[model samples]
Target: MKEGAKLIHTSRIPVRWGDMDAYGHVNNTVYFRYFEQARCEWIEQMGFPVSPREAAGPVIINASCTFFVPVNYPATLVIRMHAGEPGRSSVMTWYELFVEGQDKLYAEGAAKIVWMDNATGRSVPLPEAIRALFDAAAG
Candidate 1:
């Protein structure tokens, strides 16, 4: 990941009551869910159809998140995602979550996904079409 990366998608996720922890703040794990949704939407928007039947698609191999601020109920989170330059069989996706309409960052995350053959459960090179999609999005 680099500084000033080009973001492919931004999504707003409403903070739900169930997302809060016993401490009255958003639980740490809930932030990853927001990142997941943003990543899925970005891939869809890039013209790649995602389904179990698809011969090849991205699968998360590594993922991590960092939280900086606590979010309470009655607020929305804006998650921004970026597609990194593709590797031979994997791509890195970066995420940043901010309080809606605020500059404060709530969380940051990154994921590395390997294109896999669903039937064989083996890693495979990203399809040319999908590679092009990521390239265009990164540009």
Candidate 2:
């Protein structure tokens, strides 16, 4: 996280009725669901290398989240995500949530994931193909 970074994907989440808490506001955990969807969309859009028996090769090494404003249920939430430049064997994913049609930023967060060798269970540098995908995604 640096300031003024470029974002890759944006996903709109319609807050479900069940997302509410007793106080009539969207539950805190619900925000993470938005983050998950945003990340999934980014990966899907990249169309990285895939094999029939192989899966996406990485594990989240760290994650942190912060909330600035509260959003009530029955509203639409917009989550924007970006993958930062690759460093060693990892990539940093940044996120921000906006409520009320981009009028307000409710939260900002990040997750760091290390490219990994699934068979060996070790962190590995991102493959060149996947790195290119991220570069393209950054645009």
Candidate 3:
């Protein structure tokens, strides 16, 4: 992670009671789903609506998360996402989850998404429109 990482999107998620474990903390596995929720919102904001009928879209090739502090139930999260500069066929996304109105981070993660052609089920170059949207947001 760099100090200059540009956050391109932000989303708010409520921690559900089901998200907690018997230990009274959010389960580690649930962080990935939170990241996915924020990532999908980012994709839609960038004008690429993800849907079953879409011909092309970004697919998560890899995802990982690192928990900082344990979060219990009865919390609201503000998830921030940064979209890295696009490569030929892929882009990296970074995320940070924080308690609403709090500065401390509860979790952070990154995901590598590659453009794919649903019709062919193969990787494809990022469309020019998508690249422009990212560029504009980065600015």
Candidate 4:
């Protein structure tokens, strides 16, 4: 895969009416939600043998997005998900957002994720299965 082309999962999100702020643009917070959708979808695609109950316990250590063109209602938002650089006990999720049917980039960025033992709430090395997910998805 080319740099910035390692898409492990992708989806088109329909712009929601409520995503627009009073200024008639998608609010800054909506970018985070869009990135969340990409990450969740990628996790599901990895077939990690997880149920919703088991998946709820991860931490977002960091996240940010850079905006360019604006997206509006009734439009399709294309989201691409890929793995980022990993450390001893954490990983990053990178997202590239585009306007559907066009190459216009609306925004792009990443979130730092750390896995924790559910009971202890302490950071842990990502499990082997999850590591495989990164090996397959890392750009």
Candidates in order have lDDT scores of 0.84, 0.77, 0.89, 0.75
* TM-score per model over all chains: 0.89, 0.83, 0.92, 0.83
Error of 2 at 132 (Å): 1.7
Model 4 — TM-score against the truth?
Answer: 0.83
Which TM-score value belongs to model 2? 0.83
Which ten-residue region of model 4 has the weakest summed lDDT?
48-57
Q: Give a tens-digit lDDT track for model 3, residues 33-126.
A: 9999998987887688888589888898998888999988899999999877789999888999999989999999999999999999999999
lDDT of 1 by residue, 54-88 (tens): 88787898899988889999898899887778888
Looking at model 3, which ten-residue stretch has the lowest summed lDDT? 1-10
CA shift of 47, model 3, Å: 2.5
Report the lDDT of model 1 for residue 133.
75
User: lDDT score, residue 45, model 4?
Assistant: 66
Which stretches of model 2 miss by more than 4 angstroms?
Answer: 49-56, 134-139
Could you give the C-alpha RMSD of every candidate to the true structure, in order shown?
A: 1.8, 2.8, 1.4, 3.2
Q: Give lDDT for model 1.
A: 0.84
Residues forming the 10-long window of minimal summed lDDT in candidate 2: 48-57
Off by over 4 Å in 3: none
